[model samples]
Target: MDDYTWRIKMHQRRRRVRRERFAVLMLVVLSICGAIWYFGLYARTPEYAAKKLEQALEEKDIETFRKYAALELVLSDAYDDLTVDLFHNDTSLTPQAKSLFEKFYVLIKPQLVGATEDVICKRVSGGMWVMPEGGDMLKGRQLGIDYEEFLERSLLRSTRIKSLGEVTKENGSASIILEVLEENSHTPFTLELGMEKNDEGDWQVVSIKNYRTYLETVSPRIHQEVTEYVQATAGIVAKYNEILQSKQWDATYMSYSATGQLTKEQRTGLANYLENSVIPIVKKRQEELNQIPVPRGAMYLSNLRKESTDLSIRVWQHYVHGLRDDNIAEFNTAESLLKQMLATEQRIEDIIHRAAVSKAIPNMP
Candidate 1:
């Protein structure tokens, strides 16, 4: 009986060992299959993906563009700097100030984003905006003879992919650098695409390198016009500074009689005189400087520069409004400072708007 029982126990241990070995073998096989799927069948070649994106853009296939295209949040100190004026530098904002800032951001953000995205699409599409024979580019509209072919004929083409390098892949991410030669140049620029695998393990485009490009397709005349507008704006700003520094507004506002003499009553409240009479002079100054035409669509850079100039002027307008509101609370403490600020403010206001002081410039139609 002891011998029989011992043989039974030995047989059970042998069966257990065989099961453990089988489990180990299954794990190894499964791991090899996983590696193959992650690398081969699921993941796409980076070069192929890059070429696909290029073709999608050139062909204006909105369907394909939407498939591979994704927006990436590339965080940087530069973005922080963009918001510095709103909060970082001025941490002492009152609730009202913060609310106004938020409202301003809400107002301007969509305009900035829409305009900038249009610019980006134009750039990525090789600056091919219009269709053949002055037709509107009806993207993905089954236009005859392809958008790519249309770009090949336009004078505004910005890129032709020379060659795509072998995709570099690691840790479930891939990237490729493509050499692009333009129609007018022998030298080439490299376009790098950052790609990552999605849940289904397909490689997708994450970004278009540094978004801004050096490849704008503008006419020489437009370039010259933009240059001239920038220079003229600088000159106008200089003249504004001169007028403010000369204290011409102060002199003109002090005591305007048939003659230039002031009695004791006339000199009593400088603030009162300014509050009453200085606005007309401001109006006249605004009229004189509002002669600048609306260079809205002249050139992209010029339009942006014009917008920037107006932005500075708007800040000054806000400052003056704040000062006036503060004087109501503080019993007019900074009255002299407010007066001088408004004086300087009006000059730039007149100059930048090229229109009117205290008027809103609609960023959109």
Candidate 2:
């Protein structure tokens, strides 16, 4: 053990210390890398994305909702299912007609998709969903039924997540099963959502796997609701008709002739007859109709009836005033109002008849 041997031993000890330090540094680096992967990359899993989407929907955060939801793609997929159910359930349509409707749907799909997307965005942004006035335009008259309402009732309404099933992940893609209860129906249904990782590494919902099945499951409940609404509306309309019949309205209307040229005395008689008889009865009928409770589905019919009855009162009043003052302008106004009232009445009858023919109302006339 001389000076050279001691120096060699010191050098070996120094080397061993350096090696130990290097190993400790590597361990620290690996721990940091593992933490980053777990907290950052692993946290952004498919289930995490689905939870974010659920929270966004609950909060009505449209921007965040859009970040995770491929709305256009999902809706496009849903549209096919929707049309299939629509044409399938429509008993009035022949096979040829259904084929024509599918073609028409294809032609208008882009516009419909845009419009429906806008509606969903608006609903999410507004915090509450309500069909705006004249929104029935979304329900095409060519369909001859309320398809938009059916969609609204089935999908657009508020829903509560009942349970979330296992998330299955594939090659950069995944799926999750969600059980939800629709607020309006309180019926629970299952939805399988297809998700994929985007370029940004965030997972997004691409499509609904079981949308058609969901629609089929909910159709009977929705149809039952519609039937109940139609039946309730029919009862109210029947009561209105009964009132009209009891009043002997047709005979009363035909009793007076305002068309021919008349003496001043005859004009006075016509004015008195309308003011004393027609005006009061029309006003009373309007009041009675207004007092009746209108079902939500019958709002259109109720509004139309209200307009007609209001016009009927106004028409008789104008007729009485025209005869009393010999004012031609009042007579013209009365004629215009009469025409409008008649047209409104015709529309009411048409709707009732259509509902009856659809068998929405039993013994509807």
In order, how many clashes per candidate? 0, 0
Model 1 scores worst on lDDT over the 10 consecutive residues at: 72-81
Clashes of 2: 0
lDDT tens per residue, model 2, 29-90: 99999989876876578877887888887888999899888899988998888878765555
- Can you list the residue pairs that collide in candidate 2? none
- Candidate 1 stretches with Cα past 4 Å from truth are 1-43, 72-166, 178-191, 208-365
TM-score for each model: 0.32, 0.60
For each of the candidates, the C-alpha root-mean-square deviation to the true structure, in angstroms, is 20.6, 8.9
